[model samples]
Target: MGRGLGALIPDFDEDKAQVSELQYLAIEKIVPNPSQPRVIFDEEKMKELADSIKCNGINQPILVRKIDNAKYEIVAGERRWRACLMLKMEIIPAIVRELTDEESLQIALIENIQREDIGPIEEARAYQQLIKRFSYTQDELAQKIGKSRPAITNAIRLLDLPDEIIEHVISGTISAGHARTLLSLSVNEDRINALHKIINDKLSVRQAEDLVRRSMEIGKVPTPAKQAYVFEKESYIKENIWKKFTFKGNQKTGKFVFSYSSPEEKQELLNSLGIQ
Candidate 1:
């Protein structure tokens, strides 16, 4: 399909439903619905379910909408759809359900989220969809999902990430911890750069966080090297000749002076170095 979700799955099936209730079942047929929004199925879990289906022979059917003679849209159980596909079964058991676009999306969101398995990017997309398509407020979404406003806010923030970083995070090139650390960076470009560095350098989450903190601290300095250069020059005299001379300087090197004490110190220096 050369599209976003298509990269995850070459194709998807929507022909059947995993037998719910009468309200759930509307029809029974197999159609490959490629437009389904939910992608990124967990492979390990799919294998487990595939084993179960092999033993019990698909105990439950899935709910889907008829797209046409040979295609159908999934209303729920995308995971089941993926598992069945992996099982390589010719047909899946399903009941058809006719739902409005909004209803189907809501169901999809609830289904994926309830599993606690949706990726941050997909979850953020679903949240944005709810907001843009259905005019859902953050508070409303929070209330609907039994979460706090800050939780909702943070979840939505995932959408602000650059597409490349998001793809990296989704593809497991970087961890979620690293992704969150990158998100903490205020600038989008810097965040993206850090993301690339994290992957390239294989930096840990803590390392990424420390790098961000250092970057912020460096950002705060005023004429940083200007102040540092003066300090270094003045400290060099004291560091190299502390036993022989004392030195001091003001904000610039022009004020530096090397000092010696009375004859007693001068004689002590000569004695120490055997320079008598």
Candidate 2:
């Protein structure tokens, strides 16, 4: 069996192996780790990094593990490597260490987390991989990554969202906050409906929460005066404001919806209505 990360790094001192023994390896000989936790790299950011590298060169060396006498697999600094590759750099500085699959994944995950480059969904997937592949518990994974156990638990919970919702979270269409709000709904259909409303109305996290709460209260007895007042407000908004507008609720419970195709359109609609 392969050894755990502690056996290889011993308090992560090995990460600093580059300080004394940095070596310049041919870029062509190094490859990205297949188990790398981060899947998305911002192209604009990569271009910016490449421009900086062209001006100043790589200030930090990449971390790699010797795959064979002739090849190396990157354990960290894949973004730097990509930037260097964009500049067609012939050779790049690196620190090569011997690592098992587990060590490589742990290092990659830690590096990405430290850099804040990986998204929440990707982070959840990484935690899932560690649990399934390495038989790690939530507490153990949290300890390995220096996160609180509840944080790890919450991240993994994101995977239970529908694929469509997960795509929105990954694409920055909705935030992790909005995703968590959706999770509070017990029905999948309600969750999906709320997701549509969130994107269509450009709901903020607080608004999303209110929408979930109102949806949950749908079948309950309505307060007559409050319901009538809310209905009047919805009627007024629909007639005087946006034709796509919708309002649902009773006295203390209600949600407003205004649909738009894009953020620019939404802003234009708000501006047209003299709303800030």
Candidate 3:
């Protein structure tokens, strides 16, 4: 998925330019990244920021890159830009730097992460986008972002989940932990069942994982082919020797037996099976 799409977008990394001077630009002229990872912003939080800017004003300028003579693409501080727009500001302070689309994406992802602006799902999607658009291997991307590889892998796994379950994570119906636990269930129905139980009973992440493990164990009963072979071996000892029987194991190794009443009964039973 990544390599195919990555070709359409130009990509590279150069020495990052430092902020030297602030450039105030028209809000109308500046645009948001079409691939912005964050989809949800807290309404109350936006209001608070807008109110703050209304009175105290923006202390830190936004970041942008010139796309054309009159247009700029936001590289970071989208929330600030949006708030300024909320207040209907004509022009706002920004730091302009030349950046490739790849650099712009990486910086945007990092900035949102540092600010805790995006949720776990959004973070995952952003990581996925970075990898997809720029053809980054998971490990390569992890190194680029200074994250452990497992963190990147786990975040990407969330996207494997069903959309319903994904929405649950988005809506705060479940934590990212619970969603990952749900990923453990290979079957869609099992995942849905586990999700239902998680929400209905309010199960913790550990409990939800336990539920999946237990379900897997129940499903791991010996295959009928193996069971039939074991039962056939038991037939060799004595056909219909006893009404009650027990068997445990698989093809290479296992146990088969029935209880005897007493010492005499045990000996008689063994003798009946042609034991010395």
Candidate 4:
């Protein structure tokens, strides 16, 4: 057992319970923590760890909570358990503790966050789950996780993004910084447009922010009566044809700009509008 796990359990007496006396249980009986924040595991790193375990064996005992006489839920060391499973290890050294669900979730979150193993979105989702499931306020969550209130607030705000953009963040297609910038656009259509632009243009975080800000400002600009008809026409197009296009100029002289990443998408848009 590592000193880290020993620190969590006050009754751990290494001298009384020799290293050889540590409890070793069948690997199959242990289940992963439902509240585990880390979803993606680096396969290369896991393979490396597995190879090392094959040579030297797991140095630390995994921490688990007894669910029943025959069942256990891992509180920490899921990565180690995974590595051991990779090596086809039958039995694993473990320490069982009596823990509540809240304690289990907190410990799991702290372990992953401390190790920096979880992604930003994963961390946000963990915070959200903690708040929703445990009725934790933002301030309370911030204090518990050693983060500031604004940091906690921002993390939870990430959930407001559409599922498509959230998928991009989770998949590493765009960074958390980029996602934060997109939050400036309140409209879903505007946010989705900005997301496409970011991916297609490989826009930096600052650039994405500037682009969204400029677009928002343009939308907010006051229109003169001469241009009111043009703006109304633009609104109609946006509401009916596509909300992603840009309309400029006036009723007498106006330009409509439509952007598409591919010819296929352009053709699809044209087909949707009954245009050849």
Candidate 5:
């Protein structure tokens, strides 16, 4: 199923361990999944989570599988595990399950994508790893991850951007939208200048897009243009925001609505943006 870890994990109450598999395993015995998709965890968010766990304790048990008589590997709940470690928690509630390497990777990937604000570059690298390790076709992987094929294509496309641009995407200095807009320019110098403008000037996606478009029309980076209009509230226009949504129109103008066929898919997008 495309439902991520939720598909593999059984539903249970947060107040208590309702599943019989729940056990309080020593934290020292657990090791991180080698194929874990997330590299960077938000420091502020991690502290926030630690505070929550400190006050309330873990609401859900982590998932792990025995690697040897004395060792275990995390199947999911790495963030929870990490948080408990921060608290110097000696043992964590966990559910032991026997899963293959591919299953472990798949669960971790979906869990992060659906539940965390994983960066586009990290996300793309995760997809790349899954494809390279498992020899999965884009379509198959799309279905497995509960994302559209075009969505996968768009995410992976960000990997081809300059490493500097990729670093910006990972660091949240600039957005994947800005990087993708830079992809429109074939010249490295122009792309780098546009990236600097994005960081220094703090440009929006539409502004960046317009900037790139102008640079493409001219040979070099042109002068910044005046605003067409300013709005009172944020989210000035829906059409111009640089999300990885599918666009329908072409060359000059296009329209796309944030449509989702399932609640899970919709919620995943919202979680990625840190929206409630």
Candidate 6:
């Protein structure tokens, strides 16, 4: 029986039918908001949910809006909609909402932010989208996202990293602490190398930050040779290398020095080599 909008909804009817107040159907729907701000989605997690739906069925409905003929756009529960598709369901439950272009984007951003599910990278990208696409100021973005302006600024600055560095951060190759250290550098290349060092050495955030601050305090960051010699060498090794090596004094002034074997040791080496 077809009932009016306010009529009582049946618990179960017609062999088997699923309905959800939260999801809607739209046909020929183009994404009203073509661009989304968030970046990360845990595909594995979503697939797990899809598997659950396959076994138990979709208990919750997704929200979609009809844009035109045979097209529907997702508004909320996008993951659920995706899961439903994965399950190869012909007819899926959804709640339809008539949302304007601006309203749809706003809803999507607000929902993701409120849920705090967006990754740091995604959050930064979203904030950037709001500014670039919507022409919103940093202050305005902060207000909308309920964050401080500085927080927003730091998040956005993260995008300035080289793609490799960003990948490192995304893959857990580098800690967020180390990423922040790289972010503090003026040059992206330096940041990238610093990131590599941090990962290779497994330096703590504090250690990385200190290194950065030290570099800034000095007129020029020490060259790799100097850095290795001065900061990395032990006193005993430095003395031994200095005493044994015959090299240029100015060149030897830096952190490293090479050790030379004594004459007696060299003779012993020659005897061992059968060159006496």
TM-score versus the correct structure, for each prediction: 0.62, 0.72, 0.68, 0.68, 0.71, 0.62
Q: How much lDDT does each candidate structure score? A: 0.58, 0.74, 0.70, 0.73, 0.71, 0.58
What is the number of residue pairs that collide in model 2?
0
**lDDT tens string, model 5, 148-183?**
999888999898887667756765778788888998
Using TM-score as the measure, the top candidate is 2
Let me know the TM-score candidate 1 reaches against the reference structure. Answer: 0.62
Report the lDDT tens digits of candidate 3 across residue range 1-276.
111112222233233544347777888899888756554556568778989999998888887888999899988777788787667788999888887776777677655554545677888887887788778899877766567999989998999998768767875878999999878778887787777777767789998888878878885311222112223444333335642244555577987756542344456567766888
Q: Which residue pairs does candidate 4 place in steric collision?
A: none
- How much lDDT does candidate 2 score? 0.74
Give the per-residue lDDT digits (tens) of candidate 1, residues 112-151: 5545667777777777776777677998777666668887
- lDDT of each residue in 35-126, candidate 6, tens digit only: 44443345577678788988898776655556776676765566665565556555676666665666556556655654445667666777
**Per-residue lDDT tens digits of candidate 2, residues 100-144?**
777677677656665656788888887787788778799877776
Which candidate number maximizes lDDT? 2
Per-model root-mean-square deviation over C-alphas:
25.2, 13.4, 25.2, 13.6, 14.2, 20.6
Report lDDT (Cα) of residue 151, candidate 6: 93
Lowest lDDT 10-mer window, candidate 3? 221-230
* Candidate 6 deviation (Cα RMSD): 20.6
Clashes of each: 13, 0, 0, 0, 0, 16
Q: Model 1 lDDT vs. the true structure?
A: 0.58
Local error of candidate 3 at residue 180 (angstroms): 1.2
TM for candidate 3 is 0.68
What's the CA error at residue 141 for candidate 5, in Å?
1.9
lDDT computed for candidate 3: 0.70
Error of 5 at 245 (Å): 31
